[model samples]
Target: MKAIRIDEFVRDLATLSPKDVPSPKPKGPRDIGVQITHAALTHVDMLYAQGLHQNNGRHVKPPFILGNEFAGIVTSAPPSSSLRPGTRVFGATLGSFAEHIYADENGLREVPKQWTNAEACAVGASGAISWGSLVSVANLKRGETALILGASGGLGVMAVQIAKALGAKVIAVVGDEEKARMIKSTGADGVVDYHEKDWENKVKAMTEDGQGVHVVYDAIGAVESGLRCLRYRGRLVIVGFAAREGKMENIQANRILLKSAMVHGYRFGEDGRQDPTRTEEVWNGFMDLVVKESIKPIIYKKNYVGLESVSQALIDLGKHTVWGRAIVRINEEAERELKARL
Candidate 1:
């Protein structure tokens, strides 16, 4: 098996080595092994590489496999799971940068037969986040309005579609003209260029329903931006912080009082201590969305070829060049695609 890994403290993309590693052994009746076709990169990967992620998954040192979500075919499975060997499937697992990966029965989701690997690979992380935020966290209502910041990136684009599918009027806040146009095509009622002067006030102007938007789905937690966009008694769901710094942000009592708002910080990792049942709930919900065609992540039509490409993918994510989530594929299937002529 081959894996993409880092050694020393090198953060450059070229430092990631694609090399042969021992294949994983299946643990128990509940564990399964998958042959990976694609692995998607999350902002979490860059943070993990820099030793800045507060999440528990990245606490260990490097020379480890690096990936968060994957889409692949099943090669083996425990008796407990419904998955069967040789099934054409797409699923997600943590630390899946190699050709063959070990997956818990709960983490796997069967891909729709007609969906392309490129499409299925793109949806894994951001898709789960978006679907979970709208239906699970916010419990959003139809005919309501949502203010989504970072609405052009991976998760944001998914949320835009999901919120629209749920019958909410979406006000997407993106960086510039091109991104705004993309959101517009997704049926957003309005698009604001956040790079413009007084972008927040423009959001305020677009709010004719009441005090402000019905919900503020802020993916980027910059401490003080989205709360101000909320209507009286609106809910703000903290989904991502691609813009967050070292520490958590402070909440002002006055602002909470003035708006009568609630701030719920959400992290989507289901197995990590806080919420175990979340996986089952989110898994069923995610499958529902996938089956219904309500939302899909807008995968950029490019693939970053090798382990060396992982660094640039992370850098592009930091520089905001990664439009939607970019997949860092490091499996035998991907290896064949890039290294071999086909």
Candidate 2:
């Protein structure tokens, strides 16, 4: 099996490449063998490559395959499992940038009939994170105004669309005019250029009566401004600290006290592991929105093909050049077949 193996963390992503590795086999009764067709590139992939992500040296160590989300065809499953041989599925797990992977039943889901493998792969982690932060944690309600920071990144774009599908007025805060325009096209009610002076005030003004947003979804470390954009008793969901390069940000207690706000730190994978029932509930809700609202994960315009392209894809993501999800096509034949059916 060919896989993007990380022998050790390196400072240069370009140094990382694919190699022939042993194919994964099912380790448990519920584990399913999957032939990976496509995988999504994320910031976390970059972090893992550099040994900067929390999961590195903790949940997983060096000398492992990289990548977390993938769409694949099941090669084997337990007789009692709903998934059988040749079932198309998408899921999140380590070692996705490979020809094959073995994942737990709880981590996998059947790909929607109408979706291509590339699209399904792109949605796995980003969709879960967005759904978990907004719907499960914040309880974002319809008709409410929600402000999304880092609105043009992979997770950010998914969050924007999911928030809109939930019938919330979405204010997307981005870095530039082009990003702002792109976010608007994805159903954001308004787009704010964070480069503008007093952008936080501008975000508040976009909400009804200038009262501020009902919820602030922060994927970047803009804690101070996020607090300012929140209305009384508003919820602030912290998804990541992309802007600060993974460094934690300090929030002022006074701001929370004054507004009676609630702040939530969201780690989608960890959350799902801790509470499988709630994770299922969140996933069901997310799929419902994806199907009913015709919500699709936005793929970047650039195409990354094959396991060898994984390094460049991760580099592009680190440079912040990818507007939406960066996807790498793994099994070209499988992807072609999946697209033909669609």
Segments of candidate 1 deviating more than 4 angstroms: 56-59, 245-247, 270-274, 329-342
**RMSD to truth, every model:** 3.4, 1.7
Q: Candidate 2, overall lDDT?
A: 0.87
* Residues 139-237, model 1: lDDT tens digits: 889988899888887788888888888899899988778777777887789998777887777888898744578888888774367877888888888
Lowest summed lDDT over 10 consecutive residues: which window, candidate 2?
A: 242-251
| Deviation of model 1 at 290, angstroms | 2.4
lDDT of 2 by residue, 140-210 (tens): 99999999998898889989999988889999988877777788889999998888999889998898889
Estimate TM-scores for all models.
Answer: 0.89, 0.95
* Candidate 2 clashing pairs, residues 3+ apart or interchain: none
Best by lDDT: 2
lDDT of each: 0.73, 0.87
Pairs in steric clash, model 1: 212-231
Residue 132 displacement in candidate 1 (angstroms): 2.2
